[model samples]
Each structure stands twice: as C-alpha cells, then as structure tokens.
Target: MSDASRSGVTPRRPPPMAPMGKARYRVMMTLVALGLALLAGRIVDLHVFDRSFLQGQGDARTLRTDTIPAHRGMITDRHGEPLAISTPVVTLWANPQDLPEDDIQRLMLANALGQELDALNERIARYAEREFMYLQRRMTPEAAQQVLDLRIPGVHAREEYKRYYPAGEVTAQLLGVTNIDDQGQEGLELAYQPYLAGVPGKRRVLKDRRGRLVRDLAMLQEAQPGGDLTLALDQRLQYMAYRELKAAVTENDADGGIVVMLDARSGEVLAMANQPSYNPNNRAGLDPQGLRNRAIVDVYEPGSVMKPLAMAAMLETGDLPLDTVVDTSPGWMVIDRFTIKDIRNYGKLTLAGILEKSSNIGMSKLALRLDDPVVPAKYRALGLGQSPGTGFPGESTGSIPAPVRWSSSQWAALSYGYGLSVSALQLASAYTAIANEGRRLPPSLLKLGQSPAGEQVIDPDVARRILGMMDQVVEPGTGARRALVPGYRVAGKTGTVRKTDAGGYQEKAYRGLFVGIAPVSNPRIVTVVMIDHPRGDSYYGGAVAAPVFSRVAGNALRLLDVPPDARDPES
Candidate 1:
C-alpha cells in the first residue's frame, strides 16, 4: 500500500473498516446460523408435514370433479316404433368469480344468451360467492354452441339429454313426459322411473385460473345409461283409435271420450286413447284434466253394460238358465219408491231375452232372487271392484259398495248398472272372460312373452251363451244396426247412464258406453268406447257409442289380420 500510494496518486485509500470485536463477530455468526436453521425447518415442515394440505388447497382451485350427465332411457311400442327418446343437448354453466367483470363484455354475453343485461347482472351478483351455476339448461347443441363461440371466459357447455316424443300427442297421455331434470312425472313413465333413469358419472379435471376446463384427468366413475322399455301398445291401432275417438267426440259434440282396445287372448292393451288430449312436448299451460287416462282412471256407472255382468252373476248361481223365462209386467216395477222400467212392455222374457231386450224389470227380478253377496262377489271375481292391475298410475279400483243391507231398490239399481262405478279398463277386462271362453286374464300393458295364467271367473258354457246373447244384441237387439261391421260378427252391449252430481243424477248429462268383442265365433279384439255428455239427436249408447266401437273394432281386427268369421253374403 505504501508503494502504491507513493507511485500512484494517493492510490485508493483502503476503504475505511471498523475495528472487528470478538463479541460482535460471534453475534453476527450466530444470527446467520439462526436464519439458515429457521429456513431449513420451514422447508422440512412444508415439504413433509404440510405437503398434502397444501396440495389439496391448491387443487381446490385448479382441479375439480365434474358430473357427466347420463342419457335417459327410450320408450318404444311393441313393433319397435319410437314413442319417446332422449336427444343430445347442451347446458351452459359459469363461475361467477371467473366471469368477465367488464360491463361491455357482460352485455355481449347477455345478448348471446337471450337474457336481459340487468337480469344477468343480478344473477351474477346473487351467485358471487358460488363457483358454479347454470346459465341455461337443456339447450340444443347448435344453439348453445352459438353462444360458446363468443369465447367468453368462465362459460362452458355440458353434454345433457332432452326428451323427444316421436308420436307426439298421439302417445302423450300413455307414454307421459319427463321433467326438466328428465325424471318421469306421470303415467307409465312415472311407474317405471327406477328402471328408466341412469346413474351420473364423475371425473377429475384440470381447470385454468379463470375456471375454464383444460383437460380431463381421470374417470372416477363411468356413466350408466338407462335401459329401454318396450310397451304392448300397437302404434297403428293407437292412431286409428285416437282418430276415431276424436271424431266421435267432435261429431256428438260430447264433453270427452275414451276408446280402449285389448287383445282378448293375452290381455295386452292394444290401443288406449282419450279425448281432450295434450301435446306432451309443449305443456307450457296444460290443463291437468287433459292428462287423465280415462280408460284406467275415470269411473262411471255403466248403465245396461252391467246387465251382461249381472246376467253372468245370476247364471253363476245356477238358479237361472239361458232359456229360463220371467214375467215383466207393464215393462216396469217399483222398489223403495224408485221406479225401475224397461223400454217397453215385453211382458215375458227368457233369461237370454231379458238381455236381448235390455229389460230392467226382468234383471231386477233375477237379482232380487239371489243373495246380495252373490252379485257383488261375482263382480269382484270378474275383475270389477278392483284395479285392473296394469301397473298404470292412478288406476281406479272401481267402487262396488258392501251395503249394510241389500235393499230391493239397491238390487234393482245394481241390476241395470247403477250404485257401482267401474272404469273403462275394468269393463273391458271383465268382458275378456266372455271373449276368452270364461277365463279372465290379468290385464297387462307390457307385451307378454306368454299369456298369463287366467282366473276362471265363469263357466265356459255360460260365457258362450252370454257371448251368443250379446251377439244377438248387436245384430237384432238394442246395439242398433250402426254397430255392425260389414264383414264381421260383433257381440256387444249398450249403456246410457245419467251422470250423477252431489245432489242426484243429471237428466241431460249422460254417458254413452259400448263394450264389444268382434268375430264372436272366434273372438279376437275387445273394445270399449265411451262418450261423455253427447248432445244433439241422440245420447243413447246405441246411437253415439256403438258406432265408434264399430270403426275402432273393425280397423283393429283387420290390422291384426284376424280372419273375418262372418262371411260376406254378397261375396
């Protein structure tokens, strides 16, 4: 330093340094050691003890488990015609925190979504704390894609399903519709919901800071799609029945109507259509009444339609034979001040003649002679007073009262179809016994692999005789010529019952009903037609209801390729 200082210009004065003390040196060295130790301990704690918690916290923001919506099941007719199906759709969701805060960007998003700007703002504010919310649910894929093309942050489309009914209103009341969540709410859909709904799947996914999905990590569970359901309903027959029932209701200026056709051998419902039907696809303001499947739900006192059943009951007593005769004086009689009358004076009628003439007096005498429980018990065995067991929701077990005392008037009223209520399905099923030679098979809406074992409710000979008597009613009795098919022998009964109110029966309000089986020699199709409150020229079942039976039964028989038993006389 002295040499440099002498040679160079006062060379660099050694930077002045403070004197070093032992205590100060030790203090500085101790501080440096403490600082390194604290850092090393922190690193160990963070990488070892707190590692999992830290990782989980970080993943809570950057990773998410998403649900993959499963597709709902399909509903088809017996012939594989689609009744209801699920179509692919998209749902839009958002993370409120990740959404654009700029008013202009938000306004663009609102416009793209067809929502008001103010509404969008309110919704975002409401969900400010939530990371997820649905923007729009169940939108068409193309429609949802249009908005996603805006490239808005936090906006995402999720795959989902929308239900579509191919048969539209034609199958509406039967197949029913799903809710926005794709859950069944009514009809057969509601009955089989457990089998129709699928399990949703979960998957872990990576998300960017803006909460937009980047990539799928791993599937936590696989989506399980719902199973398909096949019904026994025949679409062609259903359409025909719907068309005819609609026309009959319109022509008669009736309130509403129901037409139910059953396969007599298998007890499978072939066609069931109700009036005042609604389009399930568009149920924005549907009346709940329009959704009623009258064939299985609504009940009515089926006037003379009960006569055949009563006759069956009487014959089951073994006290009355088909050829036995009874005197019907003046065509009328009195019981409990209730006047039960026939159409006119058919002074004396054989048991078969009573049904042929639809004689109330003759039927009253027969019922009064039997024990009260006999008729009610026989009706129960014939599937009346019970649900048809079609597994249909809201199925009515029609009321057949067990009166404390069976009065003469009660017996008289019961004889001609009063004092008890029966649904169209019940009546149709009851006649299945006569149609199937005295065996009443359990009614089914599912296509059966084989016919179920039947409960024999009546003797084969009596059912045959009753079938023959009903054939006479259609051909030369009260069913009127209008019920006749040109190329088939029809067996049926007519019923005209005055609709009752809280007070009493309404004279002007009547329900016309016809229950029939076609090709009586070898019965195949059994049909029931009901018209409520028909106006104009006639309100009788023979006039309003029988003709509908003719059209529906005639078409159904031909559609089934049931060989016509009644040869065409001209041919």
Candidate 2:
C-alpha cells in the first residue's frame, strides 16, 4: 500500500470487486457459447453440406477435364493390305496467360514453333483470355520432341492421330481423304463416315501449377475405336489398273481417265482408279477436278457401246435372231435432219456383225424396227440412269430420256448411245450383266462373303447369244480387237463419243471408252477403261482405251490365278 501511494494516488486503494454478480457471469457465458456454436456450425457446413463448392474452387486451379481421342478405323484391301491408316502425331499447344513475358523468351518460343516473333506475340495477345492455343497441329513426333526440348514455359504437347494414305494418289479418288480432325471429306470415306469414325472418350485429371498432368482422377466415358473397313479392292489389281491408266493418259496426252474392274461373278469392285488424282496426305494445291471419281461421277455419251444393249433388247423380242440381217448401204441414214453413219459402209450385216463393226446406221435401223419402249426398258433394267449403290459420294445417275418423247432422230441417237449419258461405272455394270448371263448383280464396294442374288434382266439364252456376239468384237478386224488378252477370250464393246461444250458437241474432243469381260468362256472379271479427250495419233476406244483394259485385265487375271479359257495366241 505505501508503494502504490507513492506511485499514484488512484492506485492507493484497489477498486472494490465490482463483478461478483451471477447474472453478469451467466450473460458472458451465454455469449461465449453462442459464438462457439456458430463457429462449429460453419465448420460442419463447409466440410459436409457445402463441400462441393470448396472442391470446385480447388479443382478450378488444379484439375481439368480432357478429351480422350479415338482413332479412325483402318481401311484395308480385301487381302488385308493397308490402304488408309491412322498414324500417331503430336499437337503442340500453349497457354498464353502462362507464356513468358520476356521478349527474348518469346523469341525463342517462336523460333521453336517455326513462327515469326511478332506473329507469335500477336496470336498470344489475341488469345490472352484463353488458356490454350494451338501452336502447331499434326506435327511429327520428332518435331514435337524438338519443340519440347526448348523447355519453354506454358508450352505443351498432346497425342493425336493423322490420317495417312499408304497408296497415296493411287487410292485417293476411291478412298477419299480426311480433314485435320480426322473426319472424312470425300469419296467412300465420306460415304461410310458413320462406320469409319470413332466415338471419343472423356476423363478428368489433376494438373500441377505448370499445367503438367499430376494424377488421373476418373474416366468419364470409354472410347470406342472405329471398326476396320475391309474393302472389296484388291491392292495388286488396283496398282496395276492405276499404273496402266496413268500411262495411257500420259501417252495419249489426254485430259483425264478412269479404270474400273469388277468381279463378274460376285459383282465386287476389285479396282477403281482415276487419272488427275492427288496425294491425300498433302493437299497443298489440290484441284477440285482431280478430286472427282470420274468412273462414277462423270457422265458421257457411250457412243457405240450401247449397240450391244440394243441388240440384246431386240433379241428379247423373239423376233430378231443373232443372225438377223439389216441393210446399211449408204454408210449413212437420214433421221429427221441428223444423219447416223458408220465409219465405213457395210452393205448388209447380221445383228452380230453390226455390233462387231459398230455400225451406227445399222443399229439405228434395228432400233427403229423395235417398239419404242423396248430399248429404254432394256437399258433401265440393266441399271442405266440409276446409281450402282456402291456408297461412293457424288456418284452420278446418268440421264436417260423417256422413250415416249423420243423423235425419230432421238430414237436413232439413243440406239448408238448419243442422246443418253452413262458413267464408266454404269457401262461396266451393264457389261457385267452380260458376263453374268443376264443376271444383274448389284455392285458392291465392300468385300462380299458370298455372291449376291442378281435380278434377271434378260433371258439367259439371249444373254449368252449377246455375249457370244460381243466375243467377236475382239476378233481380227473388229472394233475392240486390241482388247484381247493372250490365253483369254475377251468380250467387249468400244465407244468414241464427242465431248460436249457450252454450245454443243466438240468435233475434236472425244471420250474413248472400252468395257470388257475377260475369259469369255467363264467371264470372271469385267473391266472398263475410259480416256477423256485423247490428243494422240488415235482417239478411238479400240486404240486408246482397249489397250489399257487389256493390260489391266491381263495382270488382274494372272494375279487372281484365273484359268485360261482359250489357247494362247503364241501357243
């Protein structure tokens, strides 16, 4: 007490204990309890009831949901040779927000990305809000590795797949091509996209601050790989056809060309090729014209090739026999204002001889003698003016004028294949019916385990007679004599049609076409070759297209091990 008095007067006496009251103690205790209860409630709510919010906040910075890519299906030939494949590739990307701010660091990154520094900076600025941007897509693994070696921050590489065509330009027109995202763009690839495309999967994963994957959380969906497509194509036959067709086009200085080979018995497309093709892998300067599958998409007047179908129509009437004679004296006949003529006058000839010589006037007279609907009906039944149902994109169904509206000249023009148009594929399919004994089987682009039932378009007897008549077309002095293969009896028809322009038909331009079947005795394969606007010494089908057919058919037969049905010419 004496020391307190000396320090301060107010400290002399300690204030009497002012809070000995129970009510104040109870009130303080109650306030402390309420504060503790609120704290515990908030903690429980955060840990249990509202835990998702906290979890989401954490995941926003450290977790990502990523796409698991699925590879497109492999396209293989009938014998399992790869035609189209998916190769593993790398896609280099960057996070603009996390990219180095230093200009020197950015310059290094640009050099690694093969981009100008200014351009890289501009791109980053444009996509600053976006955390991810593609720096390079579809890069080789080596290139991606080189990019990763730079050790640039915010740069990343992801696994992807690129579509590659092993056959290159050889199968380009038939197999079509895929886009950067592996979606089909043209040809059979587009037509069968559903079957060839895969279902992508999804997964969640934890990532570090630097955006590297730290742990896989869960798989949201399983990826379904696309089903492999086994096409009816025979790679050996395809190569042979492509080589021969390309050679023929170059030799003739032609505009373009197409070659189609079919299994006569099974109606499966063995090989289909087009000239002016492009490499599907590199499409830097691809031409739209070259992208067309000319065999199925381009149509032209079949010229004299329709004569055999006309003859078959006449034979079906039971009034005209294979030996029935028609007089063609003047080499030309007037139909309205137009004149139908042959290259030379053959005074009188049987129906078979008419086809052998490709006599336009003779065919015109035979068509006039028949009822109006006969020829058109026969053509329709043979799948003319209709799609072959091969599932090829952009396939053309050629035009066929109605028979009821035909004038005398129109009917005559129809007889020699002038007014109506037909694709090379349609011509080959029609010839296939003849080879298959009047049974018109549907053409297929996929491998067939068994031969499909064919519709009977003509009587088997009539079909056989027509086939025999066509056989003579490959004999000496016949139009398509060059279509013959050694040790094989080839039957076929030749067509030379004038190319049409904006005004009308062009006199100098012609489409030379030959449709044939090999080993006439067995008729195993049907092949059609078409050369567009041949500018060489000859533009006739026999001279330009027949040789291509011969080479392709001969090689295909040998490769297939088809037995020779006739004595070898040398033997």
Top lDDT prediction, candidate number:
2
- Tens-digit lDDT track of model 2 for 1-571: 6876788765445657566676788899999999999999999999999999899899899999888889889999999999999998999998889888999888888887789999989999999999999999999999899889988889988888999999999999999998988899998789888888889899999999889888999999988888899999999999999999999999999999999899999889999999999988889988988899988888888888898887888888887765678999989888798877789889998888898888998888888887656887889999999987887888889989975667888887887888888888888888877998899888888999999888899889988988998898898777788888887899899988999989998879999989898889999999988899999999999999999998999999999999998765687
Kindly report which residue pairs in candidate 2 clash with one another: none
Off by over 4 Å in 2: 1-44, 568-571
Write the residue-wise lDDT of candidate 1 on 67-103 in tens digits: 9888788888999888989999899999998899999
What value does the lDDT take at residue 115 in candidate 1? 99
| Residue pairs with clashing backbones, model 1 | none
